[model samples]
Target: MSTVTTRTVAYPADGLTMIGHLALPAGDDRRPAVLVGPEGPGLNDFQRGRAESLAELGYVALAFDINGGRWFTDPGEMLARVTPLLADPDRMRDIGHAALDVLLAEPRTDPDRIAAVGYGTGGAIALELGRDGVDLRAIGTVNALTTGRPGEAARIRCPVWAGVGSEDPIMPPAQREAFTAEIEAAGVDWRLVVYGGALHAFHHPPVDQAVVPGVGYHPRHARRAWRDVVDLLDECVPVPG
Candidate 1:
């Protein structure tokens, strides 16, 4: 079994409590750290599972919640809940920046080697954080709706890997193509994976509700995305001393 710790971190004077799950490498040493952002406003079991899996791979990982403890079971409900927060990019950056501060303060985390991975909406936030000049080493996002933010792409300092499904409507081909071009223009090392016949939330293994008639889960893409996440971390975040 992997070792893990659940902690509550308060954002800087924001009066909102963010829940985080930290998974430590076996036998203890300051290790490279990853902040795994959940897809919804709050976190879910799949996000926690990713953290545990990362710990199994010998990196310190933290799965964080954007909203304080509330989560929506349905997609519509989730959109209604996070719409306001999503509209405000500055607030979104604050949320990520605060989390980075907390992670940097962790004694067991290697401040020099920090990266972030996010799924769906959370991936959008990770992109914002990366684009806002947060000192990340690597960034990996899965099934995200790519949006434009001013000066965001130019500020990214690390390698980026983005995954998208060919069948996902939320992230259409045109949008991903445009986003890829923007990323390339920023002069940052980046890779884009277009998975065949998969839908949104491909990395969320336990998500059972089908958003459409015939598309839901793709285990192959999910597993491959997990491996890609690991590879990105290994490339960007060095093992702690």
Candidate 2:
């Protein structure tokens, strides 16, 4: 892994000061950039580590925050915030664009080569960006099978890849089918990977805070999901030699 430099970035969105984590690789040249979104709980260490990991891979990465730097361990509190946020696509786009702006502000970021990867509600935000017509090289999400509104997916300008656990009650087979049908009908290039025997949030490491029902960690699948996201990035926006 390359030496990575990280810093805190504060930006405003959704009437709050969003504290984001920016990670840069050990280089001066501009490189492909990525926006990393956290799960519904908030932008915690796991997500920040993901940003650093991406930077080590030679990409500028920003692990953005929601909830103004609060990580909600209470399942009810998390759902209270995320449930409404998910229903409002415009708000999700606002949050995503705010983070994208932060990522773009970094000198190491190559504006032309950008991608968005998010987990859970964070993934929903990335999808909102694509649906809002952002010129993304790729959009990858885990445990987020959110489908766009009617005719909204037609605006997505890049390929989208989503990963889910086969047994995820939150994103059951029927919901997955609907999501796929929506995107396919809009002529979008998309693929969905379902990890067998896994539950919801299979990509996240187990948290000692609170046990959110239907959510569990699968170490093997988590690693595989990360590799899959990296593959999507490499395929869509390769680093310059």
Candidate 3:
């Protein structure tokens, strides 16, 4: 693993002051980049650590924020913010694009070889970026299997891999079917992985605070999902030699 450096970056996104975390692999050479979006609770240490992990693998990673610099521990507060955001694809795209711009601005980032990997509500943001037609090497979403507008997925220029819990009522069979149907009809290269006995946000580690219903952490499945995400990035956005 390469040495990694990290920093905090503040930028403007949809009238909010978004503070992002950027992790860069050692050395000055430009490298493939990835944008890490956080769960609905918003950006926190978990996502920042993910960026650092990506950097250790020799990629430039920017874990962008969703709720300015604040994170929510209250379920209602988190939903109050994320629910409306989920309903607006354009706004999601705006926030994502703003993050992309931040990642691209880094001198060490290889803009052409970038990918987007997100969790929960952040996962939806990643999908929106693909649907908005951003040229990405790959899109990986963990949970948040919400579908996009009809025919919008055709704009996706890269493969998409979504991981969800098998028993997640929030992303039940019917919703998954609907999401898959839309992507299929759009001719997008897509794959879905349902972890057995896992619930929504299964990839997330257990938090001490109150969480919304139908969410529980599966330690084993979390590791598996992370491996799958790394595998997808390796295939589509491998770090430079």
Candidate 4:
């Protein structure tokens, strides 16, 4: 197994001090990079561990912070903070861009080979980054099947993958169809995976705090989603030897 090192990174975004977590693989060689975004609750141990796991797979990974590093234990608090951000795509882009800059500035990241993966509200931010025409190799989102402003997906220059729970009321079948239609119309390469019997935030591990009505943890689907994201990276952003 390759050694992985991690560190806390502080940056400015959305008029707040954003704290991100960066993980790097053991070696001097530059490698492909992945930008990870956490769900509405904000950057937690799960998301930070994801960056480290990606580093183990030979990619430099950054788990960017949202909400100025504040995590919510109450469902209402999480929604209240994330709802407005979801309504504003430009704000989401600003947060994502700040994190992207952090990843790009890393000495070990191969700027040309980069991907973005996010969960829930973070997933929407990843999609927005693609719409904003960031030079990403690929974009993978989970539980954020939200559509962007009309005709904006055409600007995306890379493939996109979205994963969602079949029973997720927050991202129901109608929303998923609309997201697919928009991407397809724009001629963007995209794929959507629906995990059976799962609910919103199924990719997340169990939390001790109260969650929203439709939110539940599915360990199996969570592992599957992680594998899918890794597969997307392996296909679109291969690390150079």
lDDT of each: 0.77, 0.93, 0.93, 0.93
RMSD of each: 2.4, 1.0, 1.1, 1.1
What candidate 1 gets wrong by more than 4 Å, as runs, is 1-15, 206-215
TM-score of each: 0.90, 0.98, 0.98, 0.98
- Give candidate 3 regions above 4 Å deviation: none
Best by lDDT: 4
Give lDDT tens digits, candidate 4, residues 35-118: 999999999999899999999989999999999989999878988999999999999999999999999999998989999999
Q: Candidate 1 — worst ten consecutive residues by lDDT sum?
A: 206-215
Q: What is the model-wide C-alpha lDDT for candidate 2?
A: 0.93
> For candidate 2, what is the TM-score?
0.98
Judged by TM-score relative to the true structure, which candidate is superior, 1 or 4? 4
Q: List the residue pairs that clash in candidate 1.
A: none
lDDT of 3 by residue, 1-241 (tens): 4479899999999789999999999999999999999999988888899999999999999999999998999998888999999999999999999999999999999989999999988899999999999999999999878898888999999999999999999999999999999999999899999999999988878776796679999999999999999999999999877
Model 4 earns a TM-score of 0.98
Candidate 4: residue 44 lDDT (0-100): 94
What overall lDDT, based on C-alpha atoms, would model 1 receive against the true structure?
Answer: 0.77
lDDT of 1 by residue, 125-205 (tens): 788898888888898988765765754698999999999888888788898988888888888798999889998776565
The RMSD (Cα, Å) of candidate 4 is: 1.1
